[model samples]
Target: MAANAISPVAARWIRAWLILLGLLVYATILVGGATRLTDSGLSITEWQPVKGALPPLDEASWLAEFDKYRETTQYKLQNHGMSLAEFQFIYWWEWGHRQLGRFIGLVAVIGLAVFAARRWLGGGLGWKLLGLVALGGLQGAIGWWMVASGMGDTDRVSVAPYRLMTHFSLALLILCVITWLWLSLRGAPRAAAPEGRRTSILLLALVFMQMAAGALVAGLDAGRSYNDWPLMAGELVPSHYIQGDLGIRSLFEGRAATQFNHRVLAYVLWGLSLWAAWRYWGGALARPFAVLAALVSAQALWGILTLLNAAPLTLALVHQGLGVIVTLAAVYLVWRAAAPATPSPVQE
Candidate 1:
C-alpha cells in the first residue's frame, strides 16, 4: 500500500484557502469589536445556528426579532426608549456578525470536503482541518455564552468582561494557529539561534498577555473612565485601585486597576519589542522583529489617542485592529525563529 499524498500545487492552493479563511477571521474580530462597542451583541437575543444565518427578511420578521430583544436586560436597562428603527441598527450588526461566523464555518467545511474528495488531504492535513472545525464550533458556543451572561441580569447592561475576554482570547488562539500553519506551509526558513528563539517566544507570550489585559480594559469600560494618558484621573496612579471586596479580584474586576495594569503592560511590551528588534538585527528573524517593533510603537500611539479621545468608535476600532496586527507580527517572528535550520529554496 502506498501513502496518500497531495501534489505541491494542491498543497499551495489549500494554504491559500487557509490564508483567506484567516483574513475572514480577522475581519470577524473587527466586526465583533464594532458590535460590542455599539452594544449590538445582545440585539438578537437568541442563538439559531442553522436558521439564524438568513436574518430577518421582512418587516414582520424584524418586528418579531425586536420583540425578543425587548425582553433582554440590555434593552430594558440600557436601550430603553430605543425606537424600532434604532433597534434595527443594532440588530443588523449582530446579525451580520453571526452570518459571518456561519459563512466561515461553511467555508471551512467545504474546503475540507473538497480537499478530501480530491485526496489532497495527506500528511496530517485532514486532522488539522478537523481541529480547526472543532475550534470554530467552540467559538460559536463561546460567543453565545458571552452574550447570555448579560441577558437575564437586569443590573448589568453589558456582558461580563471576563466572558467577553474569554471569547476574544479563543478567537486569537484560532487566528494564531491558522497564521502559524499558513507561514509554515509557505516555506520553512533557517531556524534562529536557540537564545533568539527563546526570546521571541517570550515576546509572543507577553504580547498575548497584554491583549488579554486590553480585553479586561474593554470589558470594564475602563478606557472611558480615564481620559488622560500619561496620567489617570490627574495622578500617576489613581488614589484607590483596590476598591473592590477582594484584593486580587481588583486586577480583573476593578476598572481603575485594570486600566492601570493595561497601561503598564503596554509600556513593558513596547520595551520588549525594541529589544527583540535589536536582538534580531542581524539574524534571519530580523524583518519580522523590525515589523513587530513598528507595530507595537504604532499600537502604543493608537492606544493613547484612543484613550485621550475617550475611545471614539473609529479610533477604538483602529486600536483593536492594530492589536491584531501586532499579534500577527509576533506570531510570524516566532514562526521564523522556530523553523528548522535547513532552509527550503524560496519558492516563486
Candidate 2:
C-alpha cells in the first residue's frame, strides 16, 4: 500500500499465492502423516469429488461400508471388530487430507484466472503458471496412485515406499519453485554473490536429496526400526541392514540396516553443511549459510528425537513439516548464489 512499494505485479502475486499454497501443502502432509499413524488412509477407498461429500447418509449405508472394511486384512488382524466411533476417528484425518487438497486446487484455479485477466503477469510468467497448474493436477493423480498401492494389496494396506517418497518430493519441488519466484519478485536477488559462494547451490542440491531419503524413511516406516543412538544396532555402523537386499528394494526394506543408511546420510549431510557454513562465515555467503546450517541442525535433532520416541504422530509430523521449511530456506540460498546467463556484447 505504500508508494514505491510497487503493487505486486500479477507474477509476484501468483508467486506469493504459491508460497501460501506451499504452506497448505505441508499442513496437508502433516495430516497425511496422521492418517497413516491412525491407519485411516484407505477409509474412503474411492475418489469422489462430488459424491464423496455425502458420507453414508443412513445407517444402512454406513454398515454396508463398515462391512467392506471388515473384509480387509487390517480390520481382521489389527482392528478386529473396531467400533463405528473408532472408524470415524481415522476416517476424518484421511478425509481432511483429501479435502485440503481440493481446497489447494480451487485456489490455484482462481488465482490463475484473476492474474491472467489483469495482464499483470508478463514474459515467461504466463507459461510457467500453466506448467505449475499442470503439475498441481498431476499431484492429484499421484495421490491416488499412492492410495491404489494399498487398496489392491493384502500384505499391506499402506502406500508403497517409492510412491510415498515421490509424492513428498513433488510437494517440495513445488514449494521450492514458488519460493524462488517470490524472492525474484521481491528484489531479493544478490547484486553479486561473493566469489566461491557457488558451492552453496551444490549444497542445496545435496540437502534436497537428503530430504528425499528422509521421506523414504517415513514411507517405509523405517524410523521405528533404528532406535539406537550414536551407533546403530550396537555397532558404530550396523552392517546388517545394507547387506540383506540388492538394488533399490534394499533401500525401501523396513530393516535396521536401511534405516542406518539414512542415519549416516544425515550425519554426512550435517558435516558437509557445517563446513559450508564455516566457508560462508568469512565471506559474503556467511549469513545465508549460517542460517541454513542452523535450520538443518535443528531439523537433524528433531529427526533423532522422533526415532528415539518411536515416531509418535506429533513428533513425526513436525519433523516432516520442518523438512519443507528448511529445504525452502536452502533453495533461497542457492538462488542467490547461482548467476543467470545474461546478454553477450560484440565489438565492431
Candidate 3:
C-alpha cells in the first residue's frame, strides 16, 4: 500500500488483459442491443463463420442479399420498399455486432496465451478464462439462433423474447464473472455480508431480476407504445393488459403488461435502493448503497425519457445502458458486502 506504483509483474499483465477482455465483451453486447432495436439483426440470412467475413465484393452480391431480406416479414410488412441505401444502414449494424464478436474471440485467445506462457494462470484459474471463452463461442451460436427465429416468423420480424432474455442474461453473467475475477486479482476478497448486509444482497438480486424483466419488455416493443407512466392507462394494473390476452399473452407475447410491469418495477427498485441507502447510512455497506441509490434514480429518469420519446434509438440505448450500470453497481455493492471483513491490527 505504498504511494509508488506496484511493479508490472506477470500477474498484472494477465489482470489487465482480462479486464480489457471483459470490457470488450460487454461493449459488444451493448452494440448488439442497439442492433436489435434498429431492426437490423436479421439483415443477413445466412450465418457464415468464414464466408461472412468478406462482405459483398460486388453489386450483384449486395442485390442478392437485399432481395433475400425483402422476402422476409421484416422487409415485406415492416420495412416495405426500404431503399437499398437504407437497407445498408441496418445491415451494417448487425454486421458490426458479428464483427465485434469475432474480434473479442481473437483477443481473448491472444491474452490467454500470454497468461499461460508466463505461467500466470494455473490451477483452474486458466480454465475459468477458458470457460468464459467457450461461453463467448456458444454465445455466437445462440446469437444466430435468435436471429433465425425472426427470419421467417409470420407475425414477428424480431427474435423471441425468451431468446433475447437468454442472450442478455448470458452477457450479464459473463460480466459478473469478469468483475469477480478482476476484484480477486486486485486482492480484494469481498467483505462478508454484514449482519444486515444479506438483506441488501437480496435486494440487489431482486433489482437485477427486474432488469432481465425489463429486457423482455423492451424486446416486445412494450415500451414504445406505452406512453403513460406513474400508472398504466390511468389504473394501478391496467386489467385489460393482463386479461386482454387472457392466459396466452402472460409471458413473452404480452406487450401491454410487459411495459406496464417494467414501469412499476422501476419504481419499486428505485424505492428499495433509496430506502436502503437512507436506512443504512451508518452501516457497513453504506457507500455502495448510496451509489446504487444514485444510479437507480438516474436510470428511472432515463426510463421515463425513453418512454416519452417513444423509445427512439438514442434514448432507448441510453436507457438500457444505464439499467445495466445500475444493476452492476448493485451487484458490486452486494459482492462487497459479502466479502470477508478485514481484522484490526495486532495490539500485543
Candidate 4:
C-alpha cells in the first residue's frame, strides 16, 4: 500500500461511520419535518449551544421556557391559549431534533479524533472528515437562523420560506456528499459512462431542486391550502396566485402559487424518471433507474394524498421521508454512472 493511503480496514471503518452519520442526518430531517408540521420549531426561543442540551428538568424550568415561548409572535397570535402540557409536547419534539443534531456532531468529532489519533485516516480522509464537521457546525447556525426568523414580534407565523429552504437544502447537500464519499470508498474504481453520467447528474440536480420547492411548500404551510388533485383551487392553474406587483415573487411567497409550482415540478420529475427508466433499460443501471422511477412515482402519489388530507402528520412525515429516499436513489444512479468500470472482487 502507498505510505499516505488509508488502510483497507481503516477505510472500511471510516465509511461505516460516515454511512451512520448520513443516516442520522436523514433522521434529523424527518424530525425537522415533524417539528415544522406540528408547529413546534419555535417552542424554545433561545439557542443555547452547550447549556440547551438539558431540556427543562422541572416545573420551574418548564415554566421559564414556556414564558419565553409565550412572548413569540406565533404563540401570541396562533397558540395563545395553549396549555403547559401542550407546550411540553411540542417542546420535546424541537428538543429531540436539536439533540439529534448535537449527537451527530459529537459522533463525527469523536470518530475523527479516534481515527486521527490512531493514524487510521490517510489519503485526505482526515480532511474530508474535518470538512464534514465544519459543515455540521454551519448547519447548526443555520438551524437557529431559520428558527429566529420566525420569532420576531412582527414576523410571520413560521420561518421565512427562503431560510427554510436554505436549511433543508444544506442538509440534503451534506447528506449527498457523505453518501457519495461512502460509496466512493466502497469496492473499486470503474469506468464512467459519459452519456449516462450526464443524464444521471441532471436527474440528481432536478431531484434537489424539487426538494427545495417542496421545502417552500412546507415552509409556507401551502400543502394544506389546496386539497385537490390535477387542478388547484378548481382550475388547471390558480387564478389568485399573484397578490402583489411581483408575480414572479408569488411562487415563493404565495401559498397557492407555491403549491402549484410544487405540483408541476412533481409532474415534470415523474416524467423524467420514466424516461430514465426507459433509457437505462437492460443496462447495469436498470435496477437503480427503476427504483428511482418507483420512488418518485410513489412520492408524487404521497404528496397528492398529503395535500388532499391536509398534510396529516403521519402521511406528511412519510411524504417528507420519501424525498430523502428518492434523492439517494438518484444519487446512487449518478455514482454508478460516474464510477470507473474496473471489475473488483469486492463489488457490492
Q: Pick the candidate with the highest TM-score.
A: 4
- Over 1-348, each residue of candidate 2 has an lDDT whose tens digit, in order, gives 322233344435666787787777777778877877777877777778766666777778877777777776667777887898787787778779888888888888888888778765554566767787778888888988887777655677567778887887887787777676666665443555746456776677777888788777777777777687877768886666554445456767556655776787778878888888887687767788888889889999998899898888889888878877788878878766767442111110
User: For this target, which candidate reaches the highest lDDT against the unseen true structure?
Assistant: 4
Residue-wise lDDT of candidate 3 within 118-161, one digit each (tens)?
66664356777898888888888888888888877567777788
Model 3 misplaced stretches (Cα beyond 4 Å): 1-8, 188-190, 243-248, 340-348
TM-score of each: 0.94, 0.89, 0.90, 0.95
Clashing pairs for model 4 are: 190-340, 190-341, 190-342, 191-340, 191-341
Clashing pairs for model 2 are 241-257
Clashes of each: 0, 1, 6, 5
Per-residue alpha-carbon lDDT of candidate 1 for residues 184-227, written as tens digits (9 for 90 to 100) = 55643545556578888988999999999998888878888889
lDDT of each: 0.85, 0.74, 0.76, 0.88
Candidate 4's displacement at residue 222, Å, is 0.5
List ranges where model 2 is wrong by over 4 Å: 1-12, 54-58, 194-197, 243-248, 341-348
| Pairwise lDDT winner, candidates 2 and 4 | 4
Question: What tens-digit string does per-residue lDDT give for candidate 4 at 1-348?
Answer: 555666678778888999899989999999999999999998989999899999988999999999999999999889999999999999999999999999999998999899999997666667877898899999999999999998876657778898999999999999998997788677566556566788788889889999999999999888888888878878998888886775778878889888888888889899999998998888878888899999999999888888899998999999989999999998888988885543332323
- On TM-score, the stronger of 2 and 4 is 4
lDDT of candidate model 1 versus the reference? 0.85
